[model samples]
Target: MVLHDALSEDHVEELAQLLALIRRGSAVTRSELVQSSGFGRTAIARRLDHLMALGLIAESEPLPSTGGRMPRGVYFRADAGRLLVAELGATSIAAGICDLDCRVLSSREEAWDIAAGPESTLARLEALLSELLRDHQAKVWGIGVGLPGPIEFATGRPVSPPIMPGWDRYPVRERLAKRFSAPVWVDNDVNVLALGELRAGVGRAHSDLIYIKIGTGIGAGIVSGGRLHRGAQGCAGDIGHVAVTDDQAVVCRCGNIGCLEAVAGGAALARRATAWAREGRSGYLQQRLTEGGDLTAATIAAGAAAGDTGCVELLAAAARQIGDSLATFVNFFNPSIVIIGGGVAQAGNAFLASIRQRVYSRSLPLATRDLQIVLSSLGDIGGLIGAAHMVVDEILSPKVLSLWIKEGTPEALAGAHAGN
Candidate 1:
């Protein structure tokens, strides 16, 4: 099939749909495309040929013959381009280069504080990405970033992030775009984690689920009907600031009283443990403080593991608080699965058991009956994988594809999408 210089809207849509089908492994053969897309054999052939001509997809080995001729398998050409992805946490950064399918090819992770401000933080991210991209030969098609704060999705700017000081209204996408010359997409870190789970982790089996990240702070990412629900102002899952208690003494970093983060977040657990250690409540914690000079959520977990009643009580209390907050969401959203992740969640099975127990006890019977509460399967790499998927999803969408398919590359579309 000869490729046309100018594609009609219908042609573009069909081509995008066909490519998406193959990319997702939903329709890997010409016959499957016809059945799935309601397009004739000839139309599917033309679109597949066009995609191959553009180096976006390729024909693979023939499938087993059902009756007569064997069918050739079609698949997205993942090596056709590369995607740069970075998942920034409150105190660390994970950056990687991924193929078109969002599989990480190479990655680097290190401790880095978000409080270092946008300039410093992004510079480190760019440096790390550059290092990872240094040896790869594939052309970078786009960039995806996950930040530990609320991001204005349209502009890819930080929106008064409580933990990310000096990042308010920062032009994240524009800066990264200028540095890398690629279209950039930014989202909340938790949202990217949820995306990672949906694409490559435990949530892959369920379309409706919630991912809760408990680290320096707490937040959630909601997926409904296989779509991420960011809600109005792109802060739908900002459950950290929801008042979980009426205790005026408990203050959150966001200046909110009795916020869930103040009661059940990593910092809160660490604070309580440290105070207990200083007050001689736990001999293990006190010894740990004497040796390390400070305590953290990990210290509390360790103490609990060592059979310290104080640490056990502290973790249980925090877990119950988190579970109570999660119960409300479970009752309202009724997700099929709830994924617990982040640094604090690494406290092991006991912490997860406590959370599961509380959630099941507090939630509605119908909602809890079928819900599965589990820990993150991807661990620290979930954000990186999720960020990669974010870029791939956006760049391959029909609307964005229509803008760049004619050019055979997204280079020109980069500036337009980056708000340059």
Candidate 2:
């Protein structure tokens, strides 16, 4: 029996076009789909049948043709299944599920303990997924997990990430795959966030985009030619370690000195705030210390929003550092849009304005001319959505389709299983 891989390498080009046409909300006749997809009629018919059977596509009523026989049109089912996503942050993990059209289904936020390590954190993640999936037994397509550090793309394992300990070469994909008994994909958190933005966030309008995430750590996910550039080893956007300030005093999580993250991450901001409060230099943060609240990125952002001058200054400095590093990226990639997100991005227009001004000032005139610098459109949802996007993209691959059809969907189809 042949496996039910949805799209093979040969069918990828056509699948992409079909997805595009369906996404456009246009009623497309077979002839139109063929012309747009450049696929032979038989091939297109076969693929369309597979997609229709999978419930990803639906046939609309036949449209009347004035001068010819009526042709049936097809469109994408935006609510096929809920895509579950977990956007792992430095201090927290935001879990969300969405449908095919990238609309959020449900989301939950949980705190992270720095000393918890990978095993403990994974346990928490397992609990979270268990609860979310059980609650919505139907409509869950798969699970997508985003990490706060560099991930080996091929193996879906963490590769000596700086901030996250006890996760080196962790078999995240294998573990998740076993738990869900479904496709599980792992990716660098920032890259997934960028992908989320590319699909439905602010970067949607731009084909070439660069997404930088500044939080407890800073990194980027570069998208060029309408695809994410993961570099040779999936470490392409490790800009957090990029030297910016040249101060050899402070150490970074990546075992480096004077790194951009060391100077501008959320932890750095909190440390500076704590130092100022200890010196009695800032009364704003002192109130927090007195109240026994941990000086974190969220607290600092709140302080800055409340007219705390010291907090504002610290955030501005971080923005400057981020802009300086991005200037290099701007020169190298020259993407049409650059999006910044993460905890720091919650600083609102003040943070965005500062970064935009600096990037424009530092980048070459030609590079800056058409560049659009803005905050992330997905906000906190970027990571979750990106994770879901990864799973969806993979499950739609030909190889996965073959295996799933051979092992899972066929039996499901035979038994008339109502898979959500």
Candidate 3:
């Protein structure tokens, strides 16, 4: 979409803000848009016209009123643009195409490992997006990716991630930019998962939150003042390697001894469940293992829910260890919400209860007093949704929005497509 040439920088900013307000569902009515944004009727009308020209904002059903005339409600156009996202996990990857409002239009999950390295994995991921985009012909606005590794957010490069061997410092942003015309954002998988929760899940009402992911690895995503707090090196929440046990025998994938992930992650829990099955410690688990030959955290959770003693104990132990670390974080970050999600977190309420039990007991009274711990509402799709949202918010920043107004055009977008 080509923007008008006569728009001043301030007006362009106002237009972006107006579009954002409409998208957020915060100011839908004309009076609310004027009162909430402090923009006069004429300016608001002109900006709204610009957004409509961009095929962004649309008129919805009129809102009911107590007085004579009903006000027409405005909302973001779901077909305005498309965002492509990939959440790369340890043993699988999720690919999705979403509208500008961050709603998943179509998504598919496939069994693919990050150990396959960046080149091959990203190629496959882009192919998936291409397949989904075959029918959806909306303009590409952005691309966001969530990797199961520490990411240098500004550069979108991995940094010596333990599990991702060939991904260290790989040029993810550069490579993806070359593959697509839109801007690309890469971040830690857990961080984007927290973003997804903050906008759409249990954390939606709470700005300060800590999202703990317990899948193939154990990590924390810290959000303070409603934004992701990636520390100086983008390693703020790399808690998987935080030592929790003094047992030197427990070696982690990172070669560290007694790391939290070594004892409390999904793979770790699965190993223990396998041992129990082999020893015939839990009849339910043993019966399943006898047929399937292997166990996962999901099966262990199912076993525990079915009254299996060994499975129950194993999950409790993992949760307790993770909880010990979170207690320390609670005292420091003092987040209002603590969200537990990921494949292992599927262990259900019993698992979350175990963590909450240990954390509340270990943390200071004030920190634990009002803390609300809950499971994820978005489940496996949170990362993809959040990644798409992140890019939208990123592009909406004043300076970036102004740049898009200046340089963004259909011909330029076509050039980016060919260049990529």
TM-score of each: 0.97, 0.86, 0.92
Worst 10 residues of 2 by lDDT: 410-419
Could you give candidate 2's per-residue lDDT for residues 1-420 as a string of tens digits?
112554456565556557667767652778887788777898788877766766768998988888778888888886766666787777797877677666777888978863467778877887887777777665556667888788988777888887787888988767666656555678899889999899778988787898988887888998989888999989888888878766778888778788888888888888988887788766788899888888876777788889898878877888888888888899989999998887777877888888888888999999999889888877777788778777767665555554454343322221111222
Q: Rank by TM-score, descending?
A: 1, 3, 2
Clashing residue pairs, backbone N/CA/C < 3 A, model 3: 178-420
lDDT, candidate 3, 1-420, per-residue tens:
236548687887888888878888889988899998999998787777777676677888988889999889888886767888989999998999998779998998999988999889989998998888886877788889999999999778999988998999888877776677667889999999999999988999998999999998988898999898889999888889989988977988998899999999998888888888888888988899879856999999999999989889998999899999999999989999999899998888999989999999999999989999889899989999999888887777776666666554222333332334
Against the true structure, candidate 1 has what lDDT? 0.90
By the TM-score metric, which is better: model 2 or model 3?
3
lDDT of each: 0.90, 0.77, 0.86
Tens digit of lDDT per residue, candidate 1, span 1-420? 356646888888888888888988998988889999999998787788889888999889989886899989998899999999999999899999999888999999999999999888999999999998997977889999999899988889889999998999999888888888889999999999999999999999999999999999999999999989998899889999999889989999999899999988998988888889899999988898889766888888888898999999899999999998999999999999999998889888899999999999999999998899999999999999999999888888888888888788876677776676
**Model 3: residues >4 Å from true position, as ranges?**
1-9, 59-65, 68-70, 407-420
Where does model 2 exceed 4 Å of error?
A: 1-20, 23-27, 40-43, 62-71, 78-82, 402-420
RMSD of each: 1.4, 4.4, 2.6
Model 1: what TM-score? 0.97
Least lDDT summed over 10 consecutive residues: which range in candidate 1? 1-10
